[model samples]
Target: MDRRRLTARALAELADVTVVSLSQIKTGKQVPQETTVQRIAGALDYPVAFFHGADVDTLPAAAVSFRSLSSVTQRERKAAIAAGGIAYLVADWLHSKYTLPSPKLIDAGAERDPATAARALRQAWGLGEKPISNLIKLLEAKGIRVFSLAENTKNVDAFSCWRNDEPYIFLNTFKTTERSRFDAAHELGHLILHKHGGSNQGPQAESEANSFASSFLMPRADVLSEMPRVQSLQQILRGKKRWGVSAAALTYRLHKIGLITDWQYRNFNIQLRTDYGSSEPDSMQRETSTLWKMVLDDLWDQKLTRADIATGLNIPHGELENLLFGLTAASDRPPLRNDRPALSVV
Candidate 1:
């Protein structure tokens, strides 16, 4: 239901029932008959048992790092949370069969400064000041379970949480590649810096995440050395590609570091807003889940398919397909190596 972004009204229409009747059945106010259950299962492409599964659990909005919450609607947030639930279930199942990397993030929530926390995380992860070639791969290698959200909603950028003491990130692949990277870094900040957990609002959680993302992507020393005397929008746009970040994000970082004066920053913002708006002039290839790809290959070698896994989980095959996106291994390709370094927690 979340994957398709089907509201009660829409789902009721698809199930050939009235909105009130469907709502009553969903709310447990009335029990659905066998025929009605079959109709709903068919409409949702889910087995009747899936709805009854005790394993069906969802992460709340408060438990996640949600970007642009004001711009996001409640319905969109609910849909994203529900989608995350499906991904979490699939990941939990995969973990039981595969020796996946352990969580590598340390508790950096006590640090008041975002840049300090970012640097600390870099040191702990042994990532120095060098640019991360692929943020998704780096996170996966470090034991962060990344998944793409097919919620079909543009308002949600990305979200992260700690499930079963392991970090999980969900990105909305519908956005531009640059935005997606920033979203990935932002969620990483939440995972590392907000270890204790708090509301997304208050005490500048969003700002801290933004700061951590900027500093993490472009370290202070490296970015300072790269900054030119006369900063221009085009130069920033071109330079942003190296760090896999958006022009606006780089510009803000530059401004925060005092590399660019207020006058120059304001002028650059005017040009960037008028010309680029939300679209990135130059974009990189979309990053998919490395861990998921490897897992799918391992499972495929055993002659098990997504349909088999779906049956084991009591979910529809399409749900698993949507959760995996492009991470599923192709039958024509050989299995991936399982020799990647295993990250550890504590």
Candidate 2:
């Protein structure tokens, strides 16, 4: 509720509780009763079980790279942060159970030019000007944990952070496939170019992330070589599939790289606005978590379920569903309560 910027009085009113009671709950002076919990859950659109467990701390402001503050409300941002914390714990637990990919990125925060940083990372990753087929799969294989945001608010484009020496990226799956792809690269840029750069929320940081994303997705050499002599939106759309980017993104990149004139770029933008509105028309399949999927499948084979994972982590099943983002087939079914106590090696 604090992340939502809801005052105690307002939340109490919404939950049909007294402000003093809510204040007491906040201060840990009093535990919420069952009726209060149900009312609060209904008001917040969260599960009743979520209130039973203690809330987890979100990633620090400086540690996260939001695509834009203007895009999401404080409530949405805080919700994403809270979701990110759960993602981190889930990834951490999965890491212990399986041999996941390790981070292969080097810090490029000192690099002044974002494009240079993007190129350096491409070189480091051995991804020569070749178009990446699947951004999520590549990131997963490279040891960057990626998850889809379950909030469905559509305000958060995407955000990335590093916690406990591991990098995580969360994309708003509610957005277009093209937008989601760009968001993935944008967050990747943050992970590599802004490691430990905390709360990179200014125009400079956003510009850098955009540059990194542009170059990272559409390399200069490869994209330029294939560029059309005449400005053609259709041609670009056909080619965008090769780079797995959106028409608008390719148009901007072309203009940025001097492949197209400013007039042509503006004209293309106008056309995009008319044709696609705020979205692109494509049938690209939404990216799912490969690492988590594998882990869940293995657990299923072993008769261990998402419920088991949730119980082990002391997180609510609803919260776990948000983290898993339908990637886990077993998430739909109720998690079987494990009577065995969680194992701890001291």
Candidate 3:
């Protein structure tokens, strides 16, 4: 069998065989029974026939894929829902412009096992020390289709397609501001790493995505330069322009990369809570959202109304109106929901 991915324990459990028996199979000393093939196939999310007599060369290094999250669990579902509308919008936009390559479908649940995936992603993006901003633009430039789908929009924060050795990216509109940023980076992680099978990302995927988000959104060099020797909101605010992060987020970023002391971080969090409870900080404000405004305006110019967009994306027309009116109203919310969008025409 190919060395795709299978812990000895996981294979044993799936094959319904003893650990010793599973070891023998790995060593090519013995073959398993049909029943064992069934169990292992189910566990690996693969077909039983393949287990019996599949070529190792046909298998990939790892089995990685993402599907629209089905569980109604709030957070997971919300992620899909949030990304659904936006993904539709993005995909449609790409369809209208360039003849994008077919996108590879992905699971929305690859946050698990993100470490190895993260490294693979970094290599793919040709990114290292720099932070990633304007992820939508980056994806578009890569010729991957972006679209919107309202009906089946699973609280999707974002998704990546891996097809023909290329990747495309998508984001959901149902998330919060910070969450959206993180989602874009997360999907970017999938585009770079992972395989094409089931959408299940174990643990390493999550770690890799998180790492990509941190490095992509907040480059380490920028974080170091901005870390205040003396804790001051004013200093932090000044740093935001170059770093392109909110004060609170920047504060956390400082601590994340070991720029700030733990004592300083704790005190800073308290200070921020006291200063800007439930309201965004002045430092967090930006003249424009580089990607958000650009994409929205471009789509609007292409003769796509928010209402028309909603229909194409399978979202409620009224909901589309709400988002355009600067009033995001919906039962399901993404982790990073945004009330502010680009300029709307009519």
TM-score of each: 0.87, 0.85, 0.50
Number of the top-ranking candidate, with lDDT as the measure: 1
Candidate 2 or 3, higher TM-score? 2
Total backbone collisions, model 3: 54
| Model 1 error, position 322 (Å) | 3.1
- Compared with the true structure, all predictions reach lDDT values of 0.79, 0.78, 0.50
In the order shown, what is each candidate's alpha-carbon RMSD?
A: 3.4, 5.2, 14.0
In angstroms, the error of model 1 at 301 is 2.1
lDDT of 2 by residue, 1-346 (tens): 7434576778889999998888898789998889988998777765577677655657887677889778878778877887777776677677677766678887887455788988888899899899998888889888888887766777788998887778888888778778889999998877777775444667877888899999999999988789847457887788788898888888888888888998999998898899888777564677776666666655665687878887787666666766665765554343345522232221
Worst 10 residues of 3 by lDDT: 56-65
Query: In candidate 2, where is summed lDDT lowest over 10 consecutive residues?
Result: 337-346
Error of 1 at 190 (Å): 1.5
Q: What range of 10 consecutive residues in model 1 has the weakest lDDT sum?
A: 337-346
Which stretches of candidate 1 lie above 4 Å from their native place? 1-4, 7-13, 16-31, 274-277, 329-346
Give stretches of model 2 more than 4 Å off.
2-7, 10-17, 29-55, 196-199, 329-346
Residue 290, candidate 2: C-alpha displacement in angstroms: 0.8
